[model samples]
Target: MSNDDINARRREQVELNMLTVAAVAGWYIDTYLDKKSCRDSALSGAAYVNELLIGHLERFRQVCRMERPIFMKLCNVIRSKNLLCDTRDITLEEQLIMFLFTIGHNAVNRQVQERFQHSGETISRHFNGVLQAILSLSTQYIRDPSINVPIEIANDTRFYPFFKDCIGAIDGTHIPVFVESHKQAPYRNRHGLLSQNIMAACTFDLKFIHIQAGWEGSASDAIVLRAAEKDGFKVPRGKYYLVDAGYGNTPNYIAPYRGVRYHLREFARGSIGPQDAKELFNLRHSSLRNAIERVFGVIKNRFPILKNTSSHSFDTVTDEDINEPDDDYNTDERRREGNRMREAIANAMCDEYSIHTRRLRDRHGH
Candidate 1:
């Protein structure tokens, strides 16, 4: 062969040898480890998982952060997809439980290894395996936002018709995180706490339709939201999302009136009610937008990992199933149009509320 051809052949032989070595290394690692830090507990991870799953349904829910049925269903889905398999010593149940226990309780690898009676290497491997499986099933679990008005808005007397086009709510939250010292500046929020910014869109019933996570905590809510929009979060034609003023407004987003009384506390009992159309709109807007806040509360409470810092380098939600966000809409025009829509909706709601109030007054002879 020519000199150039001989070099090419040598390079190909080297690549083949590298692949062979890599395959052998992967197989050996899977089967063996060098003095792996092992945990020995009387209650093996498998036994503990079985006890929790078969003993009491409530206990399972408390530990797994999900009902027994849901947990089993998830296991079935992952196994069916060949995402996990039962090993000789550790069953698939143990694998999933380790993941759930860790994320649900914010347990570190050491804690998880202790509970499961497994080596740190095995624990981390299985944990990552289960996590990847769960992420793969995102399409089935993280459903699409319905284009139609949500039942909560459609059936509620106070919100129906007025918010008939509202399909969901959107908001951003800060999730505690750990980052390298060199990268810590971007992760620090205004309060000087390290965190990641997360923006999520959810239906009125508290189901997340889309999420944009992993932005630095210092990022603005608007910035995260814009990124989410770019990543396939779309508002249906003529549909809008309820947002706090901090989230900003777009043609498909209805932000509560700024510089007005918008908080639920400001409208509590014994406090003066909204006195004008603007205030009325702000009050109702706040009421509806509170759904996003509640969603965050429920999520953080359920996944303590989100509420606290992680032992790992960092964690982030991967919205792999979301589509590329469409940025075709003219933002300036959308804002102008959204303003007009808000004004019209406010006036219409004010008129109807006035009539309803008068009717109540007359019926009660107030």
Candidate 2:
């Protein structure tokens, strides 16, 4: 074929695809505006196509500058179709954004097929590719902190009276996912369901300093921590990562001193020993390190998807639904088991650390 003919064919494909996508978008907009009521439509298939095509073409000229590949593809297809006639509908940018809105709202390939007049396979392929692109582009937003410690909390007064050097809080949480048989042994949690292990280090401002996702659910919090250390997450001079009892008592990983009362309750009720300055120091350290729990609460609440197990197995499901499969498999029992393991480790560490913190406090006093 001549260059002109090839160009003409490409343009035709673009027009056909955009009209299909716009039809799908219109159905989505109606569904959202209608508040999802039970309904059926009597509109003929041909009429629906004509109406959506006209609507898409009417707005085509205005959205030519969109950078999304899907939108650009739609615009080119529509433009090619328009070459055989006059007047364009739905500009490239509008078509792309509209397509995105459909994917977000509808989230089903069959729905896209019914509304946009494309095969389910075509919609699924296009949708998954676009979703990956969107995620890849947005990854730029999840940045690590530059200074490590925020300026507001850097001064002596802010950390004052209790501890002088504090940086970020560290914790680990289980992200539930479908059991991939190949990795089933490693991914299995205590309760027998599959999950992914994620360890995060967050600062007071909620910015993630370190986030490692995609470990097997069976992995321990300590394992994640060790991996983080191996990956070279720096523990800056004079600053410590506030951790709970799950991690062992090390100079780098500090925990509350046991048998010693903290500010809240350093001296036990039945203790026959005198309440002295040694007791006071342990209390302060425990009080200062509890911020990590709050971080876990906020994250799970916002992304409830993390609270549940994946609905489909990662091994069986396509890439588009991979993240969601983990949420579907979550059960109360699984959640409790995961929570218990994490807490138990933390408490055990605290027991060990309590001994160390008391010794250190006594040494500091001398």
Candidate 3:
């Protein structure tokens, strides 16, 4: 009698467990069927493009980090080049817009999907597609400056005669980058943050002429400059570029005097005037080179995501990366010549600076 009763009770418990499992499974299936797709919304990708087509200029710029006309021009370029085409449901403009919105805000695929009312896969496809198209056009837009003297130096009294041969400013900035734990050591800068060392050559008007990106954060400015030269970034013969002390003081790549107050801050806020010609030269040099710093600031202000770029994992190297053979430059002889040239320039600047100082003191009755 005891065995029979135990066996019957065990069977009843098993049957009850099976019924509970079935009930839970049925609930999950019903919930899945009732749930709405994340992409189901009123403002579709096409609809958003149409709104932007008729929207205010400032509003479009605020959303895309570029003017609407520039945005349209980019779309036209990609389309004219046959790099991108209108999908059945989305136009070429919408495709480029999705990519721009994603990068402009550093929005991830999911965020973009929500904004454009499309599946994550769809958003990712167009984003990468537009990215490729833009990369293909880099050579067309980014180029070396013409051999002529830029107006910023040609027209300004402070720089005119001395910097008449100066073409632009060269500087390096660090941008956050993601890499594998083992690969992160190279990207870890002295500040203990993982970043990429991006070298920029820009005109005084805050326009980038040449950009060499994707270097490790720990990479030195000199190394990046060498790499850039190998990749065909040229400083015209007899002309030079203004750089900070981090770069080599070599021919056609002039750098500030090391161990001197070269940054603008050293001269601002009622700071003492330059003690000598070398100091004076550094002060003015830094002032002109400050254009590159301003360009970096402007870029970050326009795209705030650049300040903290944790949303996207930029771990891959694209075809746009330069892998050219090293260009033998910055040799000892070249550097020594560059130093002599710098000393001459500094000495030449002293007479003008003294004359300007005399005029200022006389005007102030000092």
Candidate 4:
């Protein structure tokens, strides 16, 4: 159909659906808007959505550098599916919304093609733009400008109560992604599916401070931690991230020992042996570490698409479903092939981290 015809139909559709859209927009504002400062309910909400959506789209273009054709392709799918735009005719506002929706959904070329009947190249173009937007937004949102601690935390918490400076909580999460070829093994998880090992950090307030997506699942949590430590991430000095058993105890990072409950969990469980006092220390570390769990929960909550399997052309999510080989490889050929496949597949993953001291050093400006 001609673009004009599509625009005419979309106008009618928007008119019909406007009330519901406004209601949803209201909810969006209520959930995300700053309540104390935003005095005008209706205007403030609308402005917030507009700024966020526009900023998302603009940022996407900067990061992805997508071409027009690809951008159009992605927009078509988002509009057709009623994702954000809800109309075929793309206004600047609708386009912005589409970009935000695409990033939050992690929708890629093939998925867009399948859902919107657009070509792969178009989706690719648009995908880059959306990716760029995500990168920019993530960087923008993942920082804490005020290095100082807030007053409430100083009184309420024992750790860093005086300075209100807890560096952050760290954790690794698996994101389902697809891969091509036998190289997918490394990304495969214990459940026998392909997945990306993503590592992230959040402030004491449960705000996401740093996110490193695109890691292979085969790598240990320690590995992810080590990698991030090298990345010059803003992990403050004299403060430590709360970590689980996956990481090793270091000056900057603290992890609970294996087989012991953290803090109160351990108190109910048993006293520490003299030989295991250090072990008990580790357990106490975990009690503080659990905060990352809630941060991850909130991230997933904000972006429901993170919970949905990636249905991109790369089928990164599909590879996450691959079955692990039944037996461990004893033969040279089997071992070689397995390791080769793991390395090859690992590169395809977005990233990996291991509990390497060198990597940690690099990340910490050593």
Q: Which one wins on TM-score?
A: 1
Off by over 4 Å in 1: 1-38, 315-330
Backbone clashes in each candidate structure, one number apiece? 2, 42, 0, 27
lDDT of 2 by residue, 207-276 (tens): 6777766667777776767666655566775456666566644444555444545534424556533344
How close is each model in CA RMSD to the real structure? 6.8, 16.2, 6.8, 19.1
Residue 40 in candidate 3, Cα distance off native in Å: 1.2
Residues 193-286, model 3: lDDT tens digits: 9888888999998888998888888888888888888877877789999998878898788898988887778778577889898898999898
C-alpha lDDT score of every prediction, in listed order: 0.82, 0.54, 0.82, 0.53
The C-alpha TM-scores of every prediction are: 0.86, 0.48, 0.85, 0.52
* Ranking of all predicted structures according to TM-score, beginning with the best and ending with the worst: 1, 3, 4, 2
Error of 4 at 320 (Å): 19
**Model 3: colliding residue pairs:** none
Tens digit per residue, CA lDDT, model 1, 1-366: 799999999999999999999999987876566423345567877789879988999898898898989888877987888989999888898888888899899999778777778877788888888878877787688887877777888888778799988888888899888788998998899999998888898888988888788788898887777777776677777778888887656768888788888887988857899899989999888888788899999988998998998876665344334333445544788778888888988999899999999999999999
